[model samples]
Target: MEYTYYPGCSLEASSRGYDESVRFVFNALGQKLIELEDWNCCGATSYMSTKETISLVISARNLALAEKYGRDIVAPCSACYTILYKTNHILKNNPIMKAKVNQALKKDNLEYNLSLNVRHPLEVLVNDFGIEKIVSKALIRLDGVKMAQYYGCQIVRPDRGLDDKENPQMMDSLFEALGAENIYFPMKVRCCGGMLMTTYPDVALKLNKEILECAYGNGAELIVTTCPLCHVNLEAYQDKINKKFKKDFHIPILFFTQVLGLALGGTPKELGLNRNLIPFQLKKTALEATK
Candidate 1:
């Protein structure tokens, strides 16, 4: 199971834990990831609204490289997953748009045939690795941890209907394999304001705060998400969220892969858990009760 790795930017730099643990887990599962060379940003949320062509071209370029290798590309970041998947899907559906995107690629001597299969890392794990394989490795049991799997859009919408759009169980299945309890919540696919953290931070913060509150209120001390944008907006905004709301909540925002990393017998450092802005403060009774 070898796939081209597209870390985008956030995972490589800010989400080192996501990047690190994903590598560790793939290796643990005997899967190889050949990271794309000279990859650039995937033009996240703003790309779709501001410059659609450039956004498609940027992601198309990344897929072009994947075609050169003739392997599927796995994007761990939610934004990268959505952007790349959108570009690939549209290019496959509209020939004229595909031609224009291909023409746009000529500037870099790249031509995209939409042959590259763009997949989210979560999809690869469930479809490629299989839940049985993950269940077989139960080193650290999370049986005590009742978790809420937060999808926050992207992975399960529009492009790939891999999981139940209304209710995704892939994350729950993985957590169940590790012996954790899955608390099903209807708000799994809700938006987390992504880059709006910069453009409209007040709204972003309010939204971010609500997300954590909702997750905790629903019986999850930890949130397992697949998007880098959501992770950034949710995790980095914790202090501001507490200050703004005048409350203290140390709910940990973890990548779905990071949870797998811990279950793979990797330490917090191996999983890049320490890089998080808010302490996952398990010392609190609310969190301690989960364990």
Candidate 2:
């Protein structure tokens, strides 16, 4: 299957691992991801709170561009996925708002008929490609690798129909099929404090501390997430969280795609695993056992 790929800003920069692994995994699966040319930001969560129209217009522009491709637009970033999905939903239901967005697009010789679908790579992989197919392609099995699948706050919210909002199982099911142990993590869908990390460091640090503490307590060796912001908040702030909370926390935070790519025969360097702040390495015995 082919889809229009929108990497958003984070994937292009801070989450390069996600970008690399996403491209590697999709290509390995024999699926095609045609990146949307001249794509812009999805206006994220902040813009909606301030400039609603401008946010919708900017988000819709990407949708308008993707419409021309006549294919679903797959967004790797959770914030981008939620923003674009919201833009599609609002434009489809609100005629007045749709008119305003279309009028703005007209200046650029573009228009959105709300004919596009905004999807997350997780949903696309599990739903479109099928877990069985993914399992069949595995070159490595994560038999005893304990992982906490962190979905964060946005992806399942506003009823996206991607998975269970409160308790998502898509990631769990996929990893389980690949032989990874999915730890019982209740904080999987909890807020990772998102942009609050910049605005309110104390609050964000506490939030991330809780998440890491939960994962560690549950015996998770690593935390796998779908959101770039979540990954950053949980991974980059460990030292700060440790300092403030008076506790030691050093858990490897990884993108789900990175883990999946390893199963699909991708190398650690190729999947950007070496770039992680806290290092993680699967056992050589496990690797040989899978072979």
Candidate 3:
């Protein structure tokens, strides 16, 4: 299967690991990702609060570009997925907004017919590709590895119908099918305070602390997430969270694609696992045993 890929801003820099792992995983699965050409930022959550129409126009440009491909647009970042999906929804429902957005696009010889479907890779992988098919392609099994499936807030929110809004099982089912154990985690859908990590470090630290505390309490060896922002908040803020809370939190936060790539015979370096702050490596013995 081939789809138009949108890397957004985060995946290009702060979340390069996700971009790399996502491309690697899809390629390994015999799928193709044709990156949307000349794509611009999706004007993430913050931009909408500043200016609604401008933000919609900024995001709609990418949709107009992707429409030419006549394929579903796959966005790996949760924020990008939500923004693009929301843009498509708004334009389709509100004719006035759609006219304004299309008029703006016309300046660049572009137009949006609302002929594209914005999708998250998680849904495309689990729903479209099928867990059994992915399991069949596994080169290594997770076996007894325990992990917490963290979906953050945006992906399932705004009722996208991808999975259960409250408790998503896509990640759980995929990991379980790969032989990994999904620990019971209640904070799976909790907010990670997002940009608050920059605007209000104290608040973000507390929110992250709660998430880490829940995963740790549930005996999760690692936390697997689909959102890059959540990964940053959880993994990058460990030290701050530990110092402020007087706790020693050292749990490894990994992108779901990184783990999935490992099962698909990808090395740690290939999957960008080495880039993680809290490094994670599967036991060689276990890998050899699986082979």
Candidate 4:
């Protein structure tokens, strides 16, 4: 189980915990993640709207680099996955656009023939790696933890075929394998307002409040996400959301890989759990007690 891993920009900075936990969990499962060397930014969602060709070419360069490794590319960030995947899909379908993109890539000596597949880590773990493998490797059972699987908006939308558009169950299935109770959260696939947190913060706070309320109302102990932006928005904005809405929402938002790392006998520090804005004290205590 070896794949070229694309950490993207967010994973390297704010979402470093995701990169660490993803590496830890995958290593525990006997998988190798070879990171793409000298990979640039995927131009994210905003760049696509403003500079579509440059965005496509930038994303296409990553696709081309991954193809050099002759392995499928696994990206942890949903935004990066969406951008890269969308680029691949477009270049494969639209030959004229593909030629235009290649012209931009010619300066860097990169060309995308759409030879490699782009996958999110969640997709790789659930679909390719299988639940039984993860179950067999679990050393700590999360029996009492109630979790809400938040897939956010980008990953499932635009018909990516990874999971259901409205209600995704991939994270739910993974959590179930780790013995955690999956709360029925209707807002699992809702938007986190992403960069809107910076641009239109009022709307971002409002949307985040709705998501937080839904998760809290369903009695979720924490929210698990695959997207870095969603994690940051949900976890970091809780205080602001609380201030604006005149409520107290101290829910912990964690990456699915962090919990997966825990269930696989990884320590909190090993999985960068302490880096989370909202801490998981009980899990930390449990890990320490086991130690």
> Can you write out model 1's per-residue Cα lDDT over 1-291, one digit (the tens) per residue?
899999988887888888998999998888999999999888887777888777788878888878989889999887788888888888999999889888988998899876788888888998888988887864656656768789888788873769988788888887887777777566788888877788898988888888888887888878888887788888878888999999787878888878887767778788788888765532343234334
lDDT by residue for model 4 (27-78), tens? 9999999999999999998889898788898889899878888899999999
Instruction: Quote the lDDT for 97 in model 3.
Output: 95
Writing each residue's lDDT as its tens digit, candidate 2 over 161-226 gives 768999999999999999889999999999999999999988898899999999999999899999
Q: Supply every candidate's count of residue pairs whose N, Cα or C atoms clash at under 3 angstroms.
A: 1, 0, 0, 0
RMSD of each: 3.0, 0.8, 0.9, 1.9
Positional deviation of 1 in candidate 4, in angstroms? 1.3
Off by over 4 Å in 3: none
Clashing pairs in 3: none
Output the TM-score of candidate 2: 0.98
Clashes of 1: 1
Worst 10 residues of 2 by lDDT: 282-291
Summing lDDT over every window of 10 consecutive residues in candidate 1, give the lowest-scoring window. 281-290
Model 4 TM-score is 0.96
Candidate 2 C-alpha error for residue 101, in Å: 0.7
Better candidate number, 2 or 4, judged by TM-score: 2
User: What is each predicted model's overall lDDT from 0 to 1?
Assistant: 0.82, 0.93, 0.93, 0.89
Q: What's the lDDT for candidate 3?
A: 0.93
